[model samples]
Target chain A: MSLRIPSVLVSLVALGALAATPLAAEPKSRFKVGWSIYVGWMPWGYAADTGIVDRWAEKYGIAIEVTQFNDYIESINQYTAGAYDAVTLTNMDGLSIPAAGGVDTTAVIVGDFSAGNDAVILKDSTSLAEIAGRNVNLVEFSVSHYLLARALDSVGLSERDVRVINTADPDMAAAFQTRDVTAMVTWNPIVSEIAAMPGANLVFDSSDIPGEIIDLMVANTAVLADNPDFGKALAGIWYETAALMVADTPEGAAARAAMGAASGTDQAGYEAQLAATRLFADPAEAVAFTLSPDLGTTMDHIRTFLFDKGLLGAGAPSADVIGIELPGGAVMGDPANVKFRFDATYMQLAADGAL
Target chain B: MRLINRHPGRAARLFLGSLPFLILVVAYLVASAARLADNPGDKLLPALSSFAQAIETMALTPDRRTGAYLLWSDTWASLTRLWAGLGIATAITLVMGLAIGVLPVMRALLAPVVAFASMVPPLALLPILFIALGLGETSKIALIVIGVTPFLIRDLSLAAAALPREMIVKAETLSASTWLIALRVVLPQVMPRLLDSLRLQLGPAFLFLIAAEAISADSGLGYRIFLVRRYLSMDIIFPYVAWITLLAVAMDLGLGGLRRLMFPWWGLEGRR
Candidate 1:
């Protein structure tokens, strides 16, 4: 009763091979964009659920797929890996990961920046300098880590002065409850939760760095170049949604409430997160911010931090490994290897009623 | 030649055993090729060359920032925690399991409590452990011990209780003291079963270890996997997962070999 299993396996393999042949073709009209849970990027989910994304994409005769990722790093990773055409990421991550990974990316939309959203709290102390010689828990290599470095710099100290324990974001809130974790750097919701605990004091926040920690909607440079309509539609969708979210009307409040619910928080919690987030409500203002001289200065700090942290890729002789092209014909780092292009043309068009 | 002739279908049996693995590899390759053909930058089903490159970077090369080989260091850190947790659990289970299995009074007092405690998911107790034990090696190690100890106790107790009543009667007939009988008669029989129970608990132990490390730790196989997951670096992740599988397989094989070598009679009966 010996069965000839090999023949059956071979036929199955042949069938799979035949099925795989047509999957190599690309989908020209479809584009995927990934977003993670955050105060600024919550509008993306709202736009997708409310049919706003489809409406804008329909105007351009294209389809947009909005994907949400629970993990913040995964969104940027998918974008870098070409699984998504665009992603929502912070300015520092945009410079460190995708651009450093040799993916040409464009900052199409400056969504918002964390003002007081990301913060550092102490168990009993009231000052940043008091953080020295204490175990500071944070998600290492995240925006919170960058924020901690800047906080330490402000106090005439360095990372060497304190020991950082790499605690996951979900655990940071409860980890702070422990007596050993005297200090912690984390983002909103968790930061708010920990701050409410007895004896916890907010000592530092992203407000000190102002617009340094910029949140953005960045697209693959090659994809945007091939289909400029995608960028135009995305920018239109973002500005429209941003306008709706900030408006004092009932429609706007309802929109914000939907975004809040999508982000796993209630309206009040979402509103608190939004209050700490400085939204660039106006496209003109966003364009101005992109073209401002402050961007270059902020990028310089970001590039320096990323390079120092060895996030600029191995064998990076200097911070000049990945070049960034600003809006005003300015290039930071090596122009020969420019990967991050800050093009404000789409935002400008949106502002001038041309899009 | 005699052994080969005796087992005429040995080669065929070996090939049949490996067919499933061969099919899995082929399927993965076909799927990966299709993805790479569509998008060469696909990280989920990365090409084998990319895995080689990733391995060279993470395993061979020293990290520019930390100045350590990440794979080896992570393995060492995880192995240390795992061994420490298992070692403590084994000691506690051996002592308590023997008493509860042989002494009816001890079993009545502790068996139900152990059963109830095991029902509560260990992950739920992670925060409590961190708060009580602090965010150090102690909490992580305690998580593994707490997760696997109850199952080990239960299994060892059952094995001990299932031992022949005639052996105990004979020992008592020979005027054997309780301590001497427990040690000379029971411990020898229980040692092999303890190893068997430990082998069964390894999967759960690894689960508890990874959960703890993923929640909080600077370095561990689990920590590294979760960390690199953010980058969607599947190349690195694939190799790390393969390495963990290899380590677990080796540990299981080693325990099986030890069981055979130390308790041939018990091993023979178990095989039967």
Candidate 2:
């Protein structure tokens, strides 16, 4: 009996040692980022394709996994379902999906805002005002819809002034060919493709409404709270890439091609596309863009526009609902300044050109 | 009266009875015409027609994706997946139903749980299932079993309850074993009703099965419909839906025929 007891104790000790060994070992972050084939996410893809992802991830000592999704909604769905740690999303989609799905997330980095990459292509209509009482097709509640509403407001026309057709992005180009839709508000390469087609005129583009289209590299709130250092490192990598991209020299052209190849676009097309997107190379400028005094007003516009269009749920766009600041000076929030954390320490350091 | 009856033709009555159907067709055509008039370039009708044409085109082609050759196309792959899922679900339900049906105490304890599970909408658990089992065949099959087994158990329990207590008593009195009595007395009676219930469950089972296939699956009739929807090829989608409906009807007929063959002279009214 005495011998058996000692042997049992030894066995238990051995099992404990085995379990403790793994626990003490280094754990990989399994950093998962979700992306759709949008233009803004070209950097992440470029980083991966050019092996910059490895260097950044290694600098932070984590294993990063990138997943490409065909549709924006699917990426949001996966993010909501906890399949992704980070995602590329627009300001409104960030609010709609992660926030609405009850998962607190943080918008960490400001990607390029749309300049002329998005447009409302009209057939036989020269001006926005001429589109009144005509069918204007677009995916409902998408950025295009927001752009269209803003475009219409500029011309003093309401949504009721035109017939809104529920054509999704993949079908919008084809829908235009059918001649059923007189006008369509969409993003490129759909916009570029449609404009290339004979007789399709650009009624309005994102250039008309500056700073309204904000894209971001957003992280789940819990992940950001636990790893501010990692966030800083990732931000360092992004700003460095942006610096290379905006140079517009021989090196800049190479960087452009790297980004272009990731998105399956040609070098010339990529440069043209980049020209239409105003990127903030300076971290201070990016931070200002997020926390500008006009941000509150911009969010209010988004809220009122979405609410009137029956898109936003019944509630005011409360700041607290949009973002919460962490213990560290890291800012996490909704894109339009309603929900934001202003942790510029990492971005500030990166602006000094340090990784 | 005799002269009028002599002049009465079966053809005249048939023609008179068909008038309502003809009127319905005309009304449908008129409504469609009005819709066309409302929007000349509305492409919904032409899109639907093109989709139908696409399906007919694809069906006749011996191409790999979806052609007349079932072995060469997605038809075989999808059919195999569906049947494998169905077969596993049927096996699980049968075993569970038999276990509960054969035991009165188990029936009392588990019938309500099974009933509650069946009452829950299977589609509502889709996201949960996706998270748990992923977009794989396992989740899809698991859903089918969850949706199907309770009704089978309920019916089997009732069938078991209907079996007389006297038979077991008599068997015990004669020194015959419990197993012997159950096998001799209960088994024969339950088999007929079990087959009947199986036939009845075919409709709901197929409905839930198709719905499960529709959500997040990469390949199936549901996937095919959605893929064509992306391209606005409704012509193919329509014919595919029609073909699937016909396939389901054929299944129903086969099951009905099998039921008749097995339960000959049972005089089972309202079997469907």
**What is the per-residue lDDT of model 1 for residues A192-269, given as tens digits with 9 covering 90 to 100?**
888889999999999988999999999988888888899999999999999999999999999888888887888888
Model 1 residue runs over 4 Å out of place are A1-27, A328-330, A334-337, B1-69, B269-272
Per-candidate DockQ values are: 0.34, 0.02
Residue A339, candidate 2: C-alpha displacement in angstroms: 5.9
Q: What lDDT score goes with residue B235 in model 2? A: 39
Report the C-alpha lDDT of model 2 over A1-355, residue by residue, as the tens digit: 1122234235333432332222111233767788887676777776766677778878888777777887776576556545577788876666655564445667778777889988988897687789888777676567888898898999999776886655446655655665345788889778887888887999899999888787888877667767665576568667777777778699888988877776667788787887788887778788767666555455556656645643332233443334444325433344343333334556666666666
Q: Residue B85 lDDT in model 1?
A: 98
lDDT of candidate 2?
0.64
**For model 1, how does the per-residue alpha-carbon lDDT over B153-172 read when each residue is reduced to its tens digit?**
98888888998999999999
